[model samples]
Target: MMAAIATLLATTTALLFGAIGSRGGKEPTRNPEELVTVPAAPSKPIRTSTVRSQPSAPIPLANLPTSREPTSPQLALIPKPNAERESLLERRKQAGDTGILPGVGIPGGIPGAISEPSAANALVSSLGAGVRKAAAGQPDKAYALEQKDTLMAQGTSIRCALQTRIITDHPGFASCVVTEPVYSFTGKHLLLPKGTKVMGQYDAEPDSGRIGVIWERAITPNGVNIDMESPGVDNLGSAGHPGHYSAHWGSRISAALWISIFSDAFKYAGAKYGPTQTSTSSGIVTQDPFESNTAETIQNIAKQAVRRAANRPATVTINQGTIVSIFVAKDVDFSQTIKAH
Candidate 1:
């Protein structure tokens, strides 16, 4: 009985302690620093920056290597020869050296630099001047062609005017310059600038006054060589460069003079008539056929040679600044050679 009472009292004491421990599960107040957190010190705002870079220096032209000459295998520094020539041509054109500018007398022409001689402009003025209108007409936009690319198509015309030139019956070379800038197919870029140089050659003893020209090659303003085997044409698209044929008067006269001298000397070679008893029949005696025949044969040969000398072809005279068109026979690609502005 005493043992049971002691066990009950012990169980009661354990239950009382478990109830108090379950209700006080939080940590004791002495550790208050664990519940508090210190706010981080505020940081200053970040600053951004924009840095600009300097450009590289340009290269000097003197430091560059020499360019290969188009005509020869040698190297040279022929800078802007086309431009210089064009400027000189412009000066000449202004001074009326060619008697007309490239775009003269047309409706939408580059206006004549100077007043044309009334004689030169007579026909052009007469056409418009005779048509008089009283009321002012409304202005309209000018017509323009659309250029697309740098390819100069075949059959395209590159108009050029040659300087005063004369060609003899001997093989020689000649050249011409483009009169204006040739736009590309799309009209967006330049194909050949004004003053483009074109080189070609003529054969000895041209068969006719209408000399057939095979435009050999072309050089652009920037000195880029373009391959060309284009045939020449007139403004009306007819073939060849036409010139006036002048006979060699000096050679013909010389041949005639030789003929006169030889004729007198050869006619009396057989014999001479002299005073005789029977002057009628025996006065002029016939010489041996062999000697007479030999003289006659020699005289015929001399005449033949003179005739041949006089019949040789004379020189063809092409007036200075005669214009021609290069009928391009193939597509001219300048994309790799030139850079667009």
Candidate 2:
């Protein structure tokens, strides 16, 4: 009986513990709002771009940096109305002239000369006067042209005779004696005596057998020096002293004959000979290139020598006492010298 009572109490203790465990496991579910607390709407997003401006302070007028004065001169000028411009225009209209230039009138002075003295005109005048004064004349000495007073006018032909031999190969001085007296334009007064001495330089290069020299000066018999840059001419109105011409044809002819023979020989050797084969026909049938070229060169040289010999300049031999005329290229002033006679 005691064992059955103990069993009943054990069963009662088990049922009470089971009931407490089931009630603790069944927890009540809560709302999402209560579980995850909604974040406070973000305080209006903090602005990144807006700049907070500081108040501008007033600056004193005198303390402000000022611009420096201009280094270049003031070129832009204000235009002003000219009262005389209209009057000048009216005057020009009344005169029946329509010119853009303000002062356009016939000058009182010589034609092609300006009479008015404007700024530009005065400057030009001063510049011209300055150029004429010291530039033309040396500082230490002054030079001027005296009256020429030529006895004979231009284009006068004076008869003169050569006193010295002249060879055209070399340049040299020559002298002449006047054969006839020179007279004034009217032929009333004698200008130069018959014995007047004339001198010149024969410095011209040989142009074949021809020669013409300039007579540089003339000396009167009375010992007064005169300038006569005249030309020596023949009586036939041709220039230069008429004299003997020695051709020396014998030497030229000998040289030309020898040159011709040598040239012919060279030309014969250089002539293109087509292949001529012998009975022993080796395929190599050729002329020596060096020999052919040398022959051609020699032929050309000989031809040139022959040409030179034919065109040789003849020797001009102007002997003493040959007659020549002095062409007065310009006025020959012998008045100063003739007055002494």
Best TM-score goes to which candidate?
1
| Regions of candidate 2 where Cα sits further than 4 Å from its true position | 1-150, 203-209, 246-250, 259-311, 338-341
Ten contiguous residues with the weakest lDDT in model 1: 271-280
For candidate 1, report its TM-score. 0.46
Per-candidate Cα lDDT values, in order, are: 0.70, 0.69
lDDT of 1: 0.70
Question: What lDDT tens digits, residue by residue, belong to model 1 across residues 1-341?
Answer: 99999999999999999999988996666745557788999999899897998988996667767875477533232325685467557856554533345444556433323333456556644444444332245556685432237778888998987853747577777789999888888777787899889987766566667777788998888877889999988788888777887677877777767765665465565434322233235578543322344456666866886778777886776765888888999877777765643
RMSD of each: 39.1, 26.0
Clashes of 2: 0
What is the overall TM-score of model 2 with all chains considered together? 0.42
- The global Cα lDDT (0 to 1) of model 2 is 0.69
